[model samples]
Target: MLASLYKNNHGTIAEYKRIFSSSPAEVWNVLTNNENLKLWMDHLEITDLRKGGNIQFHFHDDLGTVEEITITDFEEGRVLEFEWGKDFVRFEIRPEEEGTQLLLKQVLTEITDHTPKDLAGWHVCLFHFADVVNNEKNHYPENEWEKWYEKYREIMK
Candidate 1:
């Protein structure tokens, strides 16, 4: 599904919600654990699990460098929020009858040209997250981003 976008006096906000057929702990594991993380977003790795901790966006192959974004808020099993460029990306988890519900809110400071790409990236990553949690044996959908990118471009327009 396309993330719902809203405009504010300051900028834009993109919100996405997904329900996973797993416990809250399971969903939290996929979000914070680098083992499942690298499969979906190759560049992201959690360096710590505290408010003052950092999430590294690794440029491992080329520069061997990483961009460290500080964690703004955290509650071990419920909420995780961090800086994303000039904005904030927050993930909230809640228990559901079936499993867990994940709510992602991207607090955008501005609607830049790169917004759609980031939105689409998150969209595709969530799909992979679901598959990972469900233990799908099929290969990762490497080509899925292009389709989502197009949708986000239109949505962001």
Candidate 2:
């Protein structure tokens, strides 16, 4: 599903919500564990996991580009918020009666030409997250992202 975009005092916020049939513990494990994380977001790795620690984004290119993002807030099982360039990306997990509810919000300071790409990327990643949580194996859907990117581009315009 497309993330809902809205404005706030800090800036624009792109919010995504997903419900998983997995338990909260299972969902959190997939969200934070490195092995599971790679299945959804191959570029991101948790180098350090505390509030002041870092999450690194590796480009995996010939240049081997890497950027460190600080963990701004963390509560072991419930919340994880970190710096996303100048913005913030946060994940909040709640236990639901039927399963788990995962909420992801990216706080954007300004919408740029690249904003649609980021939003579409996250939208695709969330779909992967659901599959990972359900133990369903599949290849990354590059074509799906292109379709979402176009949708996001139209929305941004």
Candidate 3:
């Protein structure tokens, strides 16, 4: 599903929610574990899994750019929040009666030409994340993302 974008004191927030038919612990492991993370979001690597630690963001381009994103908040098996460029991205996991609820929020200080693209990217990534939680092979659906990007562009307008 597409993330809902709203205004907040911090600026804007893009909130995405997913329900997985897996235990919270299981989902948490897939979310944080480097090996599991590689299956979905290979660009991110948790260099230090703690608040005030770092999460490395890699851009596999000719320049091999890597950014050290600081972990602003962390709660084992519960919450993870980290720096995302000028903004921040947070993940909250909770055990639900059906299984687990994963909440992803991207806090944006300002909306620019790149905002919709980023939102679409996160939407697609979350879909892949669900696949990982379900023990399915991760695959990037570029066509799906393109569809979402158009939707997001309309929404942003």
Candidate 4:
């Protein structure tokens, strides 16, 4: 089962929990490698896969400019954390019966009208993560993210 919760305030926090059908090491590889990331996430350039290594992702397109993120922390087969603008995000992995348990959290430091859009974006992206682990191609819904953000902004008010 997968679940998520979000609270909008000085910062917005979103958390997602799910059980995956893969080992923590396998899942960790998908999460840490830039090549695998390109399959599921925005194009990425990771300097190193060590704790405190620099990480950056680019979503450059006609819609907008670059979306660069920095890696804050990393624990092999366990956890990874990063920052995007004023937002902080983390991914935590644990052992589970069938495979691995994954938890993803994103904290944004500022309550904007964009809260709903942000949450929805995470929702879609997280599901994409699940898809990749399940052996499906990870295709991000960039257009959907924009559309949902508009709808979410309206709902946030």
Candidate 5:
């Protein structure tokens, strides 16, 4: 069964799912490898992929950083779970008819409020993931990004 977003002692949780044309191994590599992650995700440092390992993400746009995410779980080519700040981020991969289905769950612990900016950033990031996996020459446009950011600010407030 799919994990549901729930409010717990920590915070709120958000879930997202997407199907990619790449194999599960490829997706797993992209998620785990720092160089491949940078192609889509922000700059990141992964100390290791084992349980109890630590990972860090640095936002390219603002110099903001996500430090010390402990690897709570890891299943080769299948699942990965880590503690990101007060939240937990989990990625699950399943083989599909075309390629693979990736389920991303972000458990927002300690964050009491929901903001559109947060959602918008996630939406854009997923779009970028799709674009990169599809080997598109140009990912998302600047105007589109600006629009999403604007919507984020407007809706968050």
Candidate 6:
């Protein structure tokens, strides 16, 4: 699904929602566990899992800057949010009859030249995340990522 972008007090909020047939606990595991998290978003790891805890965002290509982002909000299986550079990244989980509903929101302080690329990467990650939750191998779809990048560019413009 495409992310919806809107202005907020701080900046813009780009939110993406997904539904999974996996239970909330199952989905939560995919989002929080270090092993499962690496499968979806390789650059990120949760060093701690509570408010004021930290998450490491590594730049594999850059290798020089490893950001230990502070957790701004957290709940065992319901919510996890943290600083992402100058912005914030949040994941909210809720139980559904079949499985769980997950909302991933990235708070953007500005729509810079990199904004579209960042949003596209997120759209791709969530796409791969759904597959991993279903026990499939992690696959980054380059075509889909390109498509999303163009969509985000048009939206930002």
Candidate 1 residues 1-157, lDDT tens each?
7889887775788999999889999989888889988876788889998999999989787669889989999999999999998999999999999999999999999888888889988988787778888877556467777888889888776
Name the candidate, 1 or 5, with the larger TM-score value: 1
What's the TM-score of every candidate structure?
A: 0.91, 0.95, 0.95, 0.77, 0.75, 0.92
Model 6 lDDT per residue over 32-109, tens place: 999999988998988989999999888887556787899999999999999988999999999988889999999998
Residue pairs with colliding backbones in model 3 are none
lDDT tens readout by residue for model 3, 25-125: 99999999999898779999999999999999999889999989999999999999999999999999999999999999999998998998899889888
> Pairs clashing in candidate 1?
none
TM-score of 5: 0.75
lDDT of 2: 0.92
Q: What is the lDDT for 33 in model 5?
A: 79
How many clashes (backbone N, Cα, C below 3 Å) per candidate? 0, 0, 0, 1, 4, 0
Candidate 2 per-residue lDDT, tens place, 1-157, comes to 7889899899999999999888999999998999999988999999998899999999999999999989999999899999998889999999999999999999999889999989988999998899899988777656888888999999888
* lDDT, candidates in the order shown: 0.87, 0.92, 0.92, 0.73, 0.71, 0.90
lDDT of each residue in 48-111, candidate 4, tens digit only: 6776667766667786555546678888889898886688888999999889988888786876
> Which residues of candidate 2, in runs, are more than 4 Å off?
none
Q: How far is candidate 4 from the true structure (C-alpha RMSD, Å)?
A: 3.6
Displacement of residue 68 (Cα, Å) in model 3 is: 0.6
